[model samples]
Target: MRTIYDIEYLQEVTTEIQDWDYGLVQGMGVFSTSERYAHIELKVYTRDHYTDQIIWNVKEEYIPADLSDFRDEIEEVLTFFGNYLYALKGRREKKLVYEVIDGSFCPDTCMRSFVRATARALVNCFNKERFKPSPADLNRIRNSQANGLELLKSFLTHASQEEVVASLKNVSLTVDFKALFTENELFLINENLYNSIEILKKKEISQEAYFKKHKLITKYGDISQIGMAHLVLILNRKDLLPQVGVFQDEEIAYKFLSC
Candidate 1:
């Protein structure tokens, strides 16, 4: 018996695949545009016990110009292709898979055939289950999360000051900041966010200057640059979450949001 699976737009297209395991096939896709037509860029990859390799990097350049307007359809087509690869993970014959992918998904004409082909393939295998990352990947993620937590703790210990306390009155934090961060960290974050908000409100500083003025970035490295923005959105600027990129680290973001 065959079944159909609904595709999901899990996240913004990224070079890295999250939660990847050995022996699994995964792919990513993006919709791009030229003046004359829309293009769909798709890349598939696989990891054996030793190495990771790209199976194919394909671009379908003949999509109708108006196809870009149907963002959902683009996502659906790409996601169906993703689900097709998910079903084909262990069955992939490198030579045959490349040929199949090229002939079906990566053709020059358009995406209509690719969409229909992937949908039929998806129904044939009927699997859309996510695979867990390998043990090595799991360990790597754990270390990253630990390092990020320590970084946050260190930032709080060193950068927090008394001056930012006054600005706390104007900010209404959506999350229990106390639960996730110490008083000092919250104060520093509130101060930076307050200043950033003021800077944007007054339009007195360039966007570059606002980033430079962030307490987290000033004290820590550039990666921490996104930290203050995350804090701003996570705390008092919940309304702007839709418009901004909030999290830097995925595991840490999950933990922070869960809190």
Candidate 2:
């Protein structure tokens, strides 16, 4: 009995794809196969140990006929990465981060991180539908003064995957990202200061009115909207201070503040 497509024939047929062209995989090892269209296209790896791997065997019919849409397609891929970066802002989990950037243990901000580059590369499958800034997104910095955090939002508003890559390709991305980031930082800082002052108004202590205003913006005082505000008030009001209040760890508070 003879088979319609002999399994042994794949060896010879694979050599044809291997000799002249290299697309699906780099070397020649069966990585995986797609049984989607009832036609089996085997994924193979080339001899190169690194940097040579084929994704899958896509048919010629599946290939895009128009080059015009290619730009948008590429943009979608970039936007996927951008969204990924957005979602992982507060996430410090090393394994969670590892799942994003592909073995990328980003030690830049927090502790050591690990992400796989494959996640970044496969991002082509996920993309932004369209570019639009949500009102809730713009309001983030309005409530907090984290500029680096704010710019991530604005980057979504004014850019898409294509827009970012195009700007970078043109060498204008740095200037644009910086300018936008600076504007957001400044605006957010101002808003934080305004809000911080208002938040303090509820602390109605009679001993300090004029002095409290001056102390807040002073060099000795803390300017942080949340953290430093509590510190400033603690030092200013002896009764409300951690040492006098029902502190969970009064000794720790006293030692930490040196008060």
Candidate 3:
């Protein structure tokens, strides 16, 4: 199934430049993008005393299947901004203003190139794996440490017991649980798991309550928000209701639900 993600656009004035006078030159901006598993952000250019730069940001675990469509839209928007910057340069300065000069002060071609280059770079970044764990590795990690224990705790609450146990079995051979987790911690974790299973079987506790009770294991440290988002997407592959809590952006949650 195709996954849907959210995009956010942000614009701000920044003062990162220190050399050129903002009043005279009024050129030079950065363009950058940040990518996450469920959210993408396109940051607008900032102006200051020295330079101006455009920012494009994307946040996703994997590149969207509709990247070509997205790229076309992004390219158009960037081209518009690049043209705007070129115009600003021409209006503010006086040296051969209307002429398209190579290596000149903020030429139209330069803006176009910048926009296209930035778009391509952002696309490349999105395609690369940033923090996503492989299914086997994720299963092993979740069963081998305090951090993983807490995730398992939460997962058990959200997913079926059979599903959780099946995942654990899939990775048992690959992970050296004895080496990764101390016996005492493992004992406690096992007890918690068994107790959780019993409670779930009895249906005596609410899912939320059980999750909250076991979620305190290990302080839930170092869990990847992006990874969690990715997992949420995988779990909901059958069109199940999503149970994601890692994304700070509501748009991400909305997209997940709508998708």
- TM-score for candidate 1, residues paired by index: 0.20
lDDT of 3: 0.30
Evaluate model 2: give its lDDT: 0.27
The C-alpha TM-scores of every prediction are 0.20, 0.19, 0.21
The digit string of per-residue lDDT tens for model 1 on 1-259 reads 1222223223321222233342334332222122111222233334333422323332222222223423334445544445544454544333212112321111122344334333333232222332223364344334434454343333332222222222222233213222445556556646554444333333322333443454333322232323343565555654432222333344544444344
lDDT tens digits by residue: candidate 3, 1-259: 1211111110121112122133322121122232111112233323443433333222211112122343344445444444544454555331211111111111111233334333332332233232223464334322333243333334333323333323333333213222333455445434433322332233332233323333311123221222223233333331222233333355554553344
Q: Best TM-score goes to which candidate?
A: 3
Instruction: Locate the minimum summed-lDDT window of 10 residues in model 3.
Output: 98-107
CA lDDT, every model vs. true structure: 0.34, 0.27, 0.30
Q: What is the Cα-based lDDT of residue 24 in candidate 2?
A: 34
For model 2, the stretches where C-alpha displacement exceeds 4 angstroms are: 1-109, 114-235, 238-248
Tens digits of per-residue lDDT, candidate 2, 42-69, equal 2222244332222323322221112123
Taking the candidates one at a time, how many backbone clashes does each contain? 0, 19, 21
Ranking of all candidate structures by their TM-score, best first? 3, 1, 2
